[model samples]
Target: MSITQHQTEAGSGMKPVGKAKARFGTGRSEFVVVAVLYAVAIFLTVGTATMNVQGKSAPGPQFFPILVCIVLYLAATLLAIQILRKPNVPDNTVHPGHGQFSADMLHDLGHLGKEEDAAYDAAPSQTPGKTWKTYSDWRTIGLLVGGVMAFVLLLEALGWILSAAALFWLVAYALGSRRPIFDIGVGLLFSSIIQLAFGAALGLSLPPGFVGGIF
Candidate 1:
């Protein structure tokens, strides 16, 4: 193509082969994540069902697991719906595939898939400081992992309220919550409720730890 033709095409914002670089996030990875979460939810449901109800306790040992499974199912459903509703954003210049669902939107997925297969099949992005292109966000991931580790290490010593509150706070921070005081308060409230639910509603006594023992 001539330089004039190339300039016109660039100005018009339409590539020759109908493929463009992704601007916003593509949902293919998110869809895979949703599928994985749904599978996990299903497995947890089956496991909870097959658990040996050895005690006469009301709600049994499976009660909390059932509640967790319900939450996971609901969360996965919402995420899948969001991904389906979100249109492909291969290019932000002309806002292609931004309208409601249509054939062109589906084409965007296939086009991106072909491009990825051709380009990323052999290796990830070779950009500086980017180890892998499929995913990143290592900072937020590290924060969450650290939070889980802290919860595990502190649960027995600090009790469910403090340990779980710390986990909640870290998670909130990782997810972009900036107000530490309010987030910590909310975390404490949630942890306290979980503790109460476990103790009163389920008749399970978690470790009281130093705070509760002092009081």
Candidate 2:
């Protein structure tokens, strides 16, 4: 088949394969996702507030989760509203299927088809690297996920102080911190603050683990 036909077929094929609609694009998709997240957050918040946790002289187990949910829902709702109102105008300068699918376009289409492909391929990687061609930072997300997983796994064994310190350092490193001393210091400080807030102020029992006696 001709290159034009191939590109048309490829573009059409991509349309129905994912949740992404051409009309929504990336920005709209992000807005929709945020909106949905906020809706869920609202539900959880209201649900938790209704739960009966009438135990001791302290707030219920749902107290902090409800507070966080309220904050997250509000922030997400505002962001979604802003994005919906000011829909991002995609640069129409570079049409993907224009100029009859050249060898370069075919190569790009192949890469785009891969399971590990980026959401948008601005152009072939051979093109001069432009500032606008980058996607959201997936590395930071990976680091956050890894840190959360590690914190969950190690919290009981290593205790809140160590686990939270490690989580903070990992997240900071993921966000591009390079100075080990600074990262460690900041991590310890933040972890200690969290420890004090949850343990001392909130009267919540975090895993003291090996350091239980000292605390």
Candidate 3:
């Protein structure tokens, strides 16, 4: 096409065919995940509040969970709005055809995939280091899952103090905290604060287990 034709096309606000508009986020996957979490938060907040709390005033045992749900709701609403404002990005994933895949075809596909990956890696992203991509890594994921499991198993047996302290330390370390001793100290301090808030201030009881006498 002529230079005039190109200028005319540009002036006319015509977008190139097959090229999707850029989205604010990397993908809609994040929005979907956050949306699901938001729903869960609402459910938990409402569900837990229904539990009996005899003679307790406002902001009782259900207070903390409801607070957390509020934060989640705000975050999810903001994220959803942001995602909606941005244009939708098309999914470009390729899937295998029906029946067994051919070796030669797979080989050719792999080579092409490598080239595309290389190009993507070479290009700088618009929001480098802004997102929490590494937080979902296998090691981090394992630590989180293990910590939750351990907390559940130990909550009643070992009690809230020890179990919560361990959970805090594990999560902090998993998220890249450098000092083990410091983390442990902070973890214990945090658990103590929570215990004081609920047990002492709010007049709510927590599982004391073997340390029932002390707590």
Report model 3's TM-score to 2 decimal places: 0.61
Q: Model 3, residue 140: displacement in angstroms?
A: 1.2
Model 1 alpha-carbon miss at residue 183, Å: 1.9
In model 2, which runs have C-alpha deviations exceeding 4 angstroms?
Answer: 1-22, 32-36, 39-62, 88-136, 213-215
lDDT of 1 by residue, 89-135 (tens): 33222222223333355566654345543454344333223221234
Report the C-alpha lDDT of model 3 over 1-215, residue by residue, as the tens digit: 79999999999999888955554565555677677878888798878878787775776777787788888888888888777776344333332221234334556666445565455566535323332112237999899999999999889998888899889889989999988899889888988788888877678777887888763
Judging by TM-score against the true structure, name the best candidate.
Answer: 3
Model 1 lDDT on a 0 to 1 scale: 0.74
lDDT of 3 at 181: 92
Each prediction's Cα RMSD? 11.6, 11.3, 12.0
Top candidate when judged by lDDT against the true structure: 1
Error in Å for residue 215 of model 3: 6.5
**Model 3 regions more than 4 Å off:** 1-26, 56-59, 84-136, 213-215
Please report, as a residue range, the 10-residue window in candidate 2 with the lowest summed lDDT.
92-101
Error of 2 at 106 (Å): 29
Query: 1-215, model 2: which lDDT tens digit per residue?
Result: 69998899898885545544456555575676686677779788778878767566566567688788978877897887788787765443222333333334545667324332332354355443333242567888888888899899999998888888888888888888888788888888987787788877667777887888664
